[model samples]
Target: MAKKELKKVFNLNSYEWWRNHRRVVTFGLFLSIFAFYLGNPFHKEGKVKDTCAKLNSSFQITGDEAMKKLNLKEIKNYNNRELANYYCERYLGIK
Candidate 1:
């Protein structure tokens, strides 16, 4: 009687596959995470508004003056919370 021969089609336990593809797979996952972060940073809703409001209440400077200080033409292009944070960091020296 002749014995039938079988070939190994899939190597589930092969670490070589992961070793060879590690960089590519890692980069792809990293790119996906970055894309998700860029699309939705998960900042609280109206955080900019809230920060700006607090700044406005605490500081005597008007919004336009703040814009000028920020070297911006207008507030439309900047995020209020980030701007306020930078402002506080510079003026208040708070970490």
Candidate 2:
């Protein structure tokens, strides 16, 4: 009996259960969206810029200077500027 009840609860094609728990589902979805926005997951460039600004103010090193100082391994055929930006983001915990 317990196994049968568990199977019913876990049924994927059960619209009846969804309808009965519409409020809970809606609240969960809203909460998820709110958390996602609150986390600012898409503003990576902004974070990098902020970090670089702080680095510049503290060390007097401009973006160009920092890029020129990067000694990355040329294993992949990636662009130098892009690789430098990625390194800066990772080094400063912006990513």
Candidate 3:
């Protein structure tokens, strides 16, 4: 392709570039938050340890337990009562 043609084909200004890269930006945000939670000293230590331990064990749990282990309750998007209950009923098991 010619330079002008390529430039026309892929016009990338700040707004356009950011719009096209929104998913990457959102993923980066999620990663940053997850990393922060992983290292947060005031909390997450015991919860993470317990969750890891539960995962390592050959056990099943109800959805509530799954949510607890995954820290889903703390997730803003999926933290509503209905969703939490749904996760408990549909995705969790006990063993």
Candidate 4:
């Protein structure tokens, strides 16, 4: 059989189907990888709190003070770790 005929036999719509399902496919892959990493005990939550505490002591500034210094607004959807890390890495001149 010709190559075109062989490809038709193997469902040539596979590429088109993948193109249409990109978002679902990407989310599924991210979830699977996230689940694998979330299984680790060393990766427990509240770790950022401890890190933040260390950051506070090391920089001589509490989280609240750091937030105020950085001018992070009081939003319900805030990322303290990101803000604190930014201060640590950027403002405090810590490596």
> What value of lDDT does candidate 2 attain over all alpha carbons?
0.66
Using TM-score, rank the candidates from best to worst. 4, 2, 1, 3
Cα deviation of 54, candidate 4, in Å: 36
TM per model?
0.33, 0.35, 0.29, 0.38
Give candidate 2 regions above 4 Å deviation.
Answer: 1-13, 41-46, 53-95
Model 1: per-residue Cα lDDT over 53-74, one tens digit each? 5566766565555555545444
Clash count per candidate: 0, 0, 10, 0
Instruction: Please give the CA lDDT of all the candidate structures.
Output: 0.60, 0.66, 0.60, 0.65
Model 3 C-alpha lDDT per residue in residues 1-95, reported as the tens digit of each score: 58777777777335878889999999999999998887786465556455545544565444456556666754556634445455444444522
For candidate 4, the lDDT comes to 0.65
TM value for model 4: 0.38
Give candidate 4 misplaced runs (Cα > 4 Å).
Answer: 42-95
Better of 2 and 3 by TM-score: 2
Candidate 4 lDDT, 21-83, residue by residue in tens: 999999999999998788764553344445555756656556566566555665466666456
Worst 10 residues of 3 by lDDT: 86-95
Question: Candidate 3: where is the Cα deviation over 4 Å?
Answer: 1-13, 42-95
Give every collision pair in model 4. none
What's the CA error at residue 46 for candidate 4, in Å?
18
